[model samples]
Target: MRWLVNHKQRLIITVVFYFVVLLLISMRKNSMYKYSTETYTMYNISSSLVVSDPTGTFRAKLPVSHAFINSVYYYPTSKSLGENAIAFTMAIDHHSNNMGHHTFNVLGYNSTNMIKSVATAQTEGISRCQYTTMMARTNTLSRLEKIEIESNGVSVEVPFKLARYTAPKPVIICISPQFAAEQWQLFVMHVHAANRFGGHLHIYLTSIIESYFELMKEYERQGYITLDYWLRMKFANPRTPYFEPNQNVEWRNQAGAQTDCLLQYKEAAEYIAFFDMDDILFPRDFPTYLEEFNAVLHANPGKNYLFYGRREHEFVKASTLSEFSFTELVQSLRSSQTVKRGKVVVRPEAYNSTWIHNSKHVSFATSVQVSSPTLVHVQLPVDKNGKRNHSRDLWKIEFGPLIEKIREDDIKAIEEDIYR
Candidate 1:
């Protein structure tokens, strides 16, 4: 009994040591495990179409849930309305391949058991082509309901929660004179069409060669071009003109005839979009680009500033005898719109100085440098006939699929315009 009482202090010390060790191990596990609150939006469609959320437009395609008769998307239940609306664009893709009927739907719900609201639209036949469409309530929706879309053999139910809506910012276009004058003219036409249809566009035109001065004057006179500013030097050479600033215009010293001229002007807005003079802008769905831009900006505001368009380039051998042979390029262009691998970093500062060396050439400087939230890069339709009927003698690389969005009611009308 005397020995037991004498060892009581040593026994207590042993127990305390083991408890401290266990506590340290528990702390390490808690630090090692972290849960990300990052959420995403997915479109629940009735048709067998590719749907995705660009909230984080990573180059690698993220896994998306597809809704069959019984399967549905449940992850986006608590996301905000801005994070919930599916950016849907219709296309002619799978027309020749799938050759099946399909319908499109956007659904929202708080949970799998509870049904919210389902926005459904049916698109049928090889006659319907792919174009940009927004999945939103014609009227405001309260709390997420159940969404059901019926098309072809597929019926999809997507459950999404009702979060507050975030309106998209305006699109700012960077236009350089290096693009063909005729193509620029066509671009202006598309810009006008975009402004009238869905969203607003700000055009930044940098005069490189003196040849475009006349065209600029004409555009300005027509109200399509707004002069922001100009620069002048004390000893003006015959080749250069004096710098002038107009309230509607902003100008700077000429950096010579470099391609970076328009890129420098990217600072004019929160999101800078690129379009060659020859690219065509579709009538609607332009707001989706801005919405994607705004979402990225919201997530990584003041962190990054580079944006690039995801496009499919088609190389075709043209017959030297006929300009009409080039019309086939449009078909080649449209076929390339499917999602592909490779990341597009949106660095406005880097994009201004660093040109894409070639397709598939992504360097670290552009990728790692300046930060920008990404926007959706929708592939546009290409004219296959190679008719070369347009102004640039170049085929139309449609830009509308990536930018402008059309009303659901206007989908058929826009498709008819493409055929006409």
Candidate 2:
């Protein structure tokens, strides 16, 4: 009877142990499932929606009866007179032929004289639209006042403003339209860093959730950043024959966006830096990026491009937060080795075209390579059992105080749910 009791007790203990093990396995699977779902949702939320006028600051939409100016680019032929000559990308009526000709008038600023140019049409395969890219030059206008394009018995008048040329410091254009909610912290950090380094941010928005847009709008209102909406419909058609594969579409669009930004700000910005939201150009010795850039330019006079390699840092989840501090959270993360790829800061006068990583159509002979990195890239850290680690140590040397301030300011935004 005693032996029977012992055997029964052992069986009960074994059963309980197995039950606990199964429970743990089930919990782990559930955790992974939730993580994956969140990631998928984030991807869609970041890329799927389109908002044409978030702030209602854009001009009135053209009447449907008339062809619209889908995309307008102002590339100054002479840097001496900013935006005196301009380029236009116009979308004609659907029935219009690619060979159709039109005339555009540039109404001079505070003058009655009109600069007229004959526009030539071309077919853009990706957009599946017959558009016209016309270059118009006007010496009568000190600056662009307005553009009037007449087509198909309908005329559309669009206002134009030239970017200010008298900016005290050289400008650095940072254009990233596709940003996810998970990147809000990093985005704020990048802005602060850029401002500290004497850089102005020109951010383009392709798609973003309402909450993120609110935060961005606030930033724009403060003059800390400039926000522009990307009208995707104006650029590409879903059914175009040249439509890139789904994965490559975003990549291709990003390249095109970079090119547009380069042209848009070429005359306004003395130097343009093409960087991702996760990247920051840190100066080792100088306090701001402007100082470092000036120093480099002084060392290599008339250099068209300054290339700096990147040191990548991984984000690590903090084990504990003393008081919910982003600065503290960043300090606790881990970093990786320098990335093989690098980014460039180019003089607008030097490069006519650009890619995601490098510039093309180089007009000058001098390209300088800085021995140390002027930029540090902070990427999402490797996931270790669901914990996140960041690359805060790398920035601690030059940006410690700023990071702390960012954390303090961000905390307020977070509490108000302005930042996700």
Candidate 3:
């Protein structure tokens, strides 16, 4: 009886061992990708989605412990370089926390397999905008499926968006907390001028006012504008309150906005012109932006950008939508004055990171300096013959183009009734 009991016990042990082995094998086949690395003490949150704004907008996703990280991005750097790699752009505080305690991470996926990586090869933008960029170059192989970014303790999953690089269409990137509901007239004129010169506006609205939403949508529908909204979250700065501005918030995250545009839209456009909304780049002699850039490229061999000088526009003939045309901006163009600073029109693939005034990691640093294609920075608004008009309702001229059309119809109807 003792021998039979022992035999049964042995049989049970063998079966249990086989069952455990089979279970492990099955799990190994279906598990996420794993590597030996130091993972932080994670109180894991629910996974997030691909990083994009569905209703034509974008907002910052910051870490729970800190608000330093702006975004993580990837480009097939092998297109420009000879290796597969990813580029990261974080809009952290420029003063104290530019590098963000080195806690940010990227989780990449290929269908079901996950590849988590530590950001590497850092580049920090040194600008007075209080907020700047912390860029990284990490080697990667997986395709952009679902991307999750973690900084400090918080991890956010953002929607994935695919964009194309059309070598012919030059995109103008205007980083704004600078735009207001009050500047609708300037915005209208800027769009018309940029489009007429064969350029598309890729505007990032850091602080969105609802009044401008309809106007932005109008241009977006007309195919002249790519509107993106950014949420500032009432923080004076993205980084810890070190050199936080005591005044307005316009200059807060400009460095981050600039670098983010380069990474996000490098594949979307071949040439990118960086300037403020009011600092319009009016091309001279050449009909379109392509023609002007090509001419400059032909003139300056080995350079990847055209750095055009700027001019100051103090006033306009009228702020009325019909009266202030693209031609009017060109007519008021002041090119003779010596520009203190100029803006850049660059091939984004040639640079790894950027600032409001300059770009970093440029393989080709030599750029042509031209004086004709002036970026006219509108300093103030006036009515007639360059006189300041403080009472000008430039912002209140009823419904830009649409109202003008309505007014014309109303006038014709009145005249017809009188005659009849």
Candidate 4:
């Protein structure tokens, strides 16, 4: 003991050294392994959810569109049936300094939680954008598992969930035209002048035409109204193939136009109205027609049909009524004094298929120039002094009491904007 006391410095040094070694051993077992992290950092996963360990990667949910194979043009397994549809794709990036050889597998889960292996792939790429080979499955697949990755003796694992898939919707197309004509312009001016009497009278021909089309287009866009112009012709010369309607063909032309308009709507629409170039329709006319049309359709769900009504025209002199559109009126008139009268109203036999042409008994009844309406306001032209123009022979009949009533009704409820 006396000799040990003389070498106390050595004993102190030995005890201190033993204590330091003991502390380091305890930290290594209970705490973190202290190596140079600069050489190898933990796996930094890029995903929606936060990962607990920087070195370890966790699962992410896959997008539905990319996961599913849309159309299988060619498949290795089947030649005739083509490729069965699969759900979507899952993508992951391995960003590390060292290239890795990795193994991956895909799995799926239904409403009930049974997991099944669906696909597998392997990759050995050298650089960035060099991805581990994709795992593809022929069947509808959803979830994925990154089962293994090997680089420097460490294996990383990740699992991605499959999301629901959906397809895109189809599109529709439109093909109706806007309707306007010279007669509408003339009628509007006369009525506007009739009430107001005088203004600058600044009527730009182009502006009037444009405004008319604009009005028609607005109505058409709302699916409330449509306009049509028709022409009929006889072959003037076979070699030239020149076509011309007879001298008295305008009325028939109008009818043909109306029939053509109805054909475009046969598939989707239930009712169609024929408006003559000379007929002045108030704005309410559209809504009223639609209402009446729907009522007719409601009564008889899906039959090729329509309802006929009397046409009432208000002249400069007095109110008059006719069951004919203006075109039909022209056909009815031989001279102002001579009017051939019959049941003038007609419901077209679905466009491209009017039965009027086939029947020998029906004269003055053909495509574009058929059908009468509930109202027609015949405002014949007048001179500067307000004396009515045109031959009186053109309009000779005084409408019966019932049609006279409708004419009066239309006049009372007419609005100024409809003329505009």
Candidate 5:
């Protein structure tokens, strides 16, 4: 009894240590139980689809009938508070008539922790044969992470990174896929004129011949152009009836590609102009499109989109088709009796969706048509029959001899190619 009394303090300490260990074990077991259950349920219930980065940047593709996640944009709700939110653009197959309600599950994790969040997507615009543009929004204040989207028994995963909150420059130009790889000269002219106007150009190509691909890559390396390639599916039997025909798929894919470009550079560009390879927007009053755009914005600050009208021009019969300069060609052409539809320049902050030639789902209001002579459309001259009709009115406009910048080697190479 006396010995027991002497060691009483030590006995109490031993008992307390055992109790503490038991409590920690119980807590850890419970945590593991919950985690295992949740993870198991997620894995068992969800179907996993393949994810691909179309742009090798902020865009991802989901298998929702070959749907695409165009752009993932991140911005803080309040700069002072540091709370963040994410907005993304999505493009689905136009033939999908019954989208019903769509939602996205964002599973965010780096290397250690994972968090799952859900956001309901809202449809912004739908082009039946082209694409359907939708926007998904999450106001969850968290770090940007990977995205997982599940629809109709399929799920896709993609890495998500935050884009700049604002663009450093006022204007960036985005061009849809130019499948016609032989038109290298026209493409160069488009790039040169855009750069000359203090605008950056981003081109998305669906499929290009090997030579054009190499040329674009060289241009990309030179910091003059940002180019992205999309791999199209090839069928064993071209005549076989598929769920979505190639033509229909191409149309939607092109629209999605355009949206992807818009979303990719939305933060880095205040205004995005959607132009085709064979088209250019010539500003009559100002030295560059940037200046003209700024004037239009000043006049219509509340407007979210500016739509320009176009005048079509055809090639002259006198010029030899084999060897031609785009600049000389434009000067020789005259306007066609039939007017061509124009293109659009949209404020990224105010518009969430865009078409090939127009902006849709504007946040503010409808687009305003800028007056003529301010924004002129210079269409590429096409040779129809033996007579060419190019617009003579736009000849007075000076675009600073942009064709002179085209490399002689490039012209010769394109001319020599059989594809032309």
Candidate 6:
């Protein structure tokens, strides 16, 4: 303390302070966990409440950087875009920074040298993010071994694996970001439903409450679905302590993740269906989902999207899949169909991006194409304030050999996780 009071010591201390501050700023790239402690003055934590210190992270820089690419892939959309293409997944940014100017350059290289490249097309001022595509000539991407994209100067490179213009699976299922999702029963039910429909589900895994990581891993091993972490945003400065209204918008920003999923499966999966866990796009008259989609396409030619009107109802969740009853679920549906909200099945190549209910852009290729068929939506999740949402009278379903198709072993595969 006496040394600091001296002018020479004071000068030395000032230089050391700024040197340490600059050092910390430079080391921001490598982040470690944030440690914190809480002492309850009112009650003893050991007796009254359980205290668990999560391996939490430091307050990440809001809007990490310009053009944060969630993912990147080579999409040979020659048949759809009339050329070869490389799709850069959505770049989510802060609402303020999203409006800033952005420049993108996409480069492709073979083993030896840089072969070809293109300027990636970026969206204008959007809400939170903008997805871009780099276009090339027909069948030219087959030789590229590496792909790199530069966004406003920051660049990221990925090892490229060239895929054909076509995808193998006819149907791919996608849902928006799953944040703090703890309903293992609902998750198992969704997986069973997708597998039953012959679809591979893809999800942007933001957060899960308990043993779902293990649960998701098992499903991944069984080839039922794919889950990957997204850089989900957080409300740095929130107005309310609950942050209910702005939480999903700030944290999940599901539209960006959904768009990323759509782009990833656009060429890999012949048909992409965006569904929530509770929504069921069951085949009414046909035996399978593909058959039903094809039938609708044949009936309404030139239409690419099939949007089903949905019926809402309260779904009672069971502990096991064996105990779950689709018959009971159907009997609980509201008699009248919902007007604006419904799930949609689409030809992935048909749209550029999607919203919560529908695509961002309106076209003949969207929900307007088919109108007769509908899906059953189960709204079991309560409101933000934890209130039960009621439904109307019940309606009948075709049932149509679906019960017979249920495999007991497959049901048991997912049901095993519920109790664990």
Position 36, candidate 4: lDDT:
26
- Poorest stretch of ten by lDDT in candidate 1: 16-25
CA lDDT for candidate 1? 0.30
What TM-score does model 2 achieve against the real structure? 0.57
Error of 6 at 261 (Å): 1.9
Question: lDDT ranking from best to worst?
Answer: 3, 5, 6, 2, 1, 4
TM-scores for all candidates: the values are 0.30, 0.57, 0.64, 0.31, 0.63, 0.62
TM-score of 1: 0.30
Query: Which scores better on TM-score, 1 or 5?
Result: 5
Q: Give the per-residue lDDT of model 2 (tens digit) for 211-308.
A: 45676688878777876554443212111111112222334245445555665676778788887777766566666676777788898877768887
- C-alpha lDDT of all candidate models, in order: 0.30, 0.48, 0.52, 0.27, 0.51, 0.50
| Model 6, global lDDT | 0.50
What tens digits encode model 5's per-residue C-alpha lDDT throughout 110-225? 45666666766655444444336556666544554555554433455644556555543567778776563545656665665565566767776655544556667877787667
Backbone clash count for every predicted candidate, in the order shown: 58, 9, 6, 25, 10, 0
- Give the local distance difference test score of model 4: 0.27
For model 3, how does the per-residue alpha-carbon lDDT over 1-420 read when each residue is reduced to its tens digit? 011223322111111110000000011222223412522222212232122223322223222212334555555544552334566554443332334335446677777678787755344455443344567655545566776665544466654333334533565555444533346656766776676667878777643344455667877887877766543422322221122221212255665567666767676676788878877765665667778788888888888887766655543545544454444443443332435577778877776676666765554357877766467666455554656565534522221111001123333433333233
RMSD of each: 28.1, 19.1, 19.0, 34.5, 20.5, 14.8
Summarize candidate 4's per-residue lDDT along 1-420 as a digit string, tens digits: 111223322111111110000000011222233332333223222321211333233222111101111111112122211233121112223232111332323233345443433432222122223122122233322222222222222222323222212111010011112122323434442233222211111111111233344544564454332222221122211221011112222222222222233233323233333333333222222234344344444555443344232243433321222221332222222212212221121233332212211212233323222133333444353232456555744665454332322233444323332433
Error of 6 at 320 (Å): 5.0
lDDT by residue (1-420, candidate 6, tens digit) is 112333432211111110000000111233222212422122223232112223222122322222334455565444465445666544333331332334355667667666445443434223432222112122235456776655444455644434344443578777766755656656766776666667677866655543556777888887788875655332223211111111323334565566667766666777888787666555656656788788888778778888876655444455544665544433333433343467678877786566666665647354544455555555453332435435322333222212222334444543453333
Candidate 1: misplaced stretches above 4 Å?
1-170, 193-219, 227-268, 279-289, 299-303, 313-333, 337-420
Off by over 4 Å in 6: 1-65, 76-78, 81-84, 92-103, 120-142, 151-168, 233-251, 320-337, 362-369, 381-420
